[model samples]
Target: MVNITKDTEKEELIAQFWPQISRAAAGYENRPALSDELAQEMALSVWRSLEGFNDQCSLSTYIYRVIHNTAIDHIRRHSKISEDELDEAMLCESPTPEKNTLQAQRQKQLIVAVNQLPLSLRQVMLLKLEDLNNIEMSEVLGISEANVGVRLHRAKEQLSKLLAGMN
Candidate 1:
């Protein structure tokens, strides 16, 4: 297994995976400020953990596992936030120049649904969204492949229900 030994390698990994990391962070937090804060925390965590990253899994899986774990911890620590504080913390997602209003609105609805999913389901769904196969997701999450499939199936069902309700 190749060991991570250089700052440049670390920088390259971060640059390459930043979009996935950003989306995962934003998808986890659902609030712009918190998402940015969460993403920064993820970057720092990934930077520190670089030396320990064994090449057993793909870099994508490893980085995602770190980000997901960090996001979970952040959520746990902030669990005591009040309803009003949560409302105050909420922010709309930023608009992408290429996406029109209808597209943006649909995307927003999807994001909201994703954020509302239980973490296990969300993790599997997010990883799947990034095009990881069942094996990679299972390895990254330390769950059985069967479990990943079950969770994904349930998550998709839930998401469909959620979108249906929104319509």
Candidate 2:
């Protein structure tokens, strides 16, 4: 059927997109271990949706959209736990002193705080921290430059509050 041919073509396109997808994903360190899985999912989504792409945007832009959305989806799905629960779980685990338990606790707090942010604000923060410039971020998030600024501002404020409470 036509679907089979299209699926095969999509698989080939995913192969082409893999390297850049992984590179783009590298800058997200909050959950570094999920990078490979997230990148592959993004690449496959872009490939499957390629036929419907209107060419209104650059291929890079389209790919970025796919990756950004996938990352946001991952974050939202994993953000359900309360900070208290996270802290309790971490405390229960026994880590070596060389592992710097305090530093690990702080990092966990940071991630939990980020998770508490609204999805739009969280996405902006993550993309910005990943070092994507305004234009690149706009392309990736499918948002206006001005909106990205607003979201980043709100996200920073929320993160500061969360961090302050964590100490």
Candidate 3:
């Protein structure tokens, strides 16, 4: 556990990393607003775990991994989806918007489809969308750069299929 003694260095570290933590958390916005609460919890966990960090990865990468694991943990804890709930959720269709709506329905559908991707693929895609190169994504995801490329390819394929099916 990281001892947060009343030290300026510890305070500075926390301040520097908070935005990365929040950006990592933003990946979960498609889930319930509970994700924000979970993000806060994860940030606290990262702070507590900081002393043990050995600088194996960049600070940003480490924080992102922490946030990702925290979100997965939260989902596991709260996701008690029964068969009926799954069926109902699967049956729920995107709502049609009027012609004058600010955003196109297709765009909304695409967003929903992206949100439905499995966590690993979704995380990769989100990081890619944020313009991180494969090396950076590899660090953030604790995978090889080649694996990052493969996953991004598969994620794009899956998203394409999902969007096609939505139409």
Candidate 4:
């Protein structure tokens, strides 16, 4: 809720973008404590970077770029992600507890596999999970749309292999 500028407040930005920030952070670090710490760091980075934001890209795009950069910095500092399950509440509610349990297991497995990807492919997959179009991902990652497409394709292939080996 700290004031960033007369026009916009940090709290307002956090409220609007916290989900994306959290998801991006979790993509980098799975352990709950570390992921939460990364999310806070990303929010602070976004708050600090807000003043520099121009209309060159959408606010979502700007927010994503800041968070991803924060995540990369976090990875460099921390150097590893310990295995952990995602919060169950983050998963869809199934008709039964058994189905929900199974779904959660699969999701956890998928996340673990994703965490094993090379950084370049991991970045694209995480952005893709956030539903970014290739163009948006390109702008956020400062790569070409074609590169995004290639990475996404490779990520999907690799994830399939990783998940298969998990079973």
Candidate 5:
């Protein structure tokens, strides 16, 4: 009975947050294989961290914090994910026996452009994409709401320039 209760709690935890965690990892790494690895790592971390979770923040915000921190750690260990690498990642996903869909191509371009951004800008964009409000993003990134707004604005400008150049 004790084991069953613990297992059910862990399952609930994983089910509740896995999509957000996976999406964040995908945006952060921009590489399917790496993102998959990161998502698994994040899930494990969440399971471990749940043992001592406090109610200081909403669970969603806390999960975002963990995902963001994991992303930073991944970036530190393997700094500078390059444009060529992004291109290669895209190429690897190209359709076989069928032409590439326009939507897929645009998504690939957007991902590449995003990956080219500086860390601050990238972090802002990623959090914003996840539909997090500025306040929640501030909590995740440990910055002021004003600063998040500034970074997000700058990141949008840079992304426009990058996409324009790419196209």
Candidate 6:
């Protein structure tokens, strides 16, 4: 296994995990512009926190914690401003010509549904999407493994209801 060293470039590390960072940010902020900004903030935060990464857990777990923490910060910073409610009609009935594929449309709908979930559930769902197991999620979230399982179960149930409503 290649070990991370001080000489490892931040650009390389960020590039490797950009997809995860972006996805986590998008889960927190439905607005693409704000999500992009959050992802950038996460990348910078990861670089700054790299020195503190003692290998107590997997590197991916550490990165997720950083990204999620940054997302929480973003939410707190913008808490005073009310976000526009997502229209249920817009979630499913958007017949935009550009997005022609059925799968793409469904994916977009799922993302919208996920974004509508409460923050606690949303965090678990997003990390679950990243393929993190309960233990890993608990470590990153600072919650118990049992709590992770409960949250994941709740997230799935809510997502199902949300998606069902869309159909």
- Name the runs in model 2 displaced over 4 angstroms: 1-40, 46-60, 71-79, 83-105
TM-score list, all predictions: 0.87, 0.60, 0.67, 0.85, 0.87, 0.86
Order the candidates by TM-score, highest first — what do you get?
1, 5, 6, 4, 3, 2
lDDT of 4 by residue, 1-167 (tens): 22246445767888899998888887888777789999999999998888787778888898899999999999999866433344443343345676558787797787778888999999999999999999999999999999999999999999999999989
Q: Write the per-residue lDDT of candidate 6 for residues 3-120, one digit (tens) a residue.
A: 4556466668889999999888877886656778988999999988877788888888888999999999999887522334445334445476757888878888888888888889
Candidate 4 — which residues are off by over 4 angstroms?
1-4, 82-100
Q: Per-residue lDDT for 66-137 in model 5, tens only?
A: 878888888888756676887787778748533366776677677778878898999999888889999999
| Superior by TM-score: candidate 2 or candidate 5 | 5
The 0-to-1 C-alpha lDDT of every candidate, in the order given, reads 0.83, 0.69, 0.70, 0.84, 0.82, 0.84
Cand. 5 TM to true fold: 0.87
Reference-based lDDT, residue 124, model 6: 97
Query: What's the lDDT for residue 120 in model 5?
Result: 93
Q: In candidate 3, where is summed lDDT lowest over 10 consecutive residues?
A: 26-35
Backbone clashes under 3 angstroms, per model: 0, 0, 0, 0, 0, 0
User: lDDT of model 4 at residue 166?
Assistant: 81
lDDT of 3 at 68: 71
**Which digits, one per residue and each the tens of the lDDT, describe model 1 over residues 4-56?**
87999999988888898898888778556778999999998898888998887
In angstroms, give how far residue 32 of model 3 lies from its true place: 3.5
User: Which has the better lDDT: candidate 2, or candidate 4?
Assistant: 4
lDDT of 3 by residue, 112-164 (tens): 66677887888888777667789989887789999999989999999999989
Q: Which ten residues in a row have the lowest lDDT in candidate 5?
A: 1-10
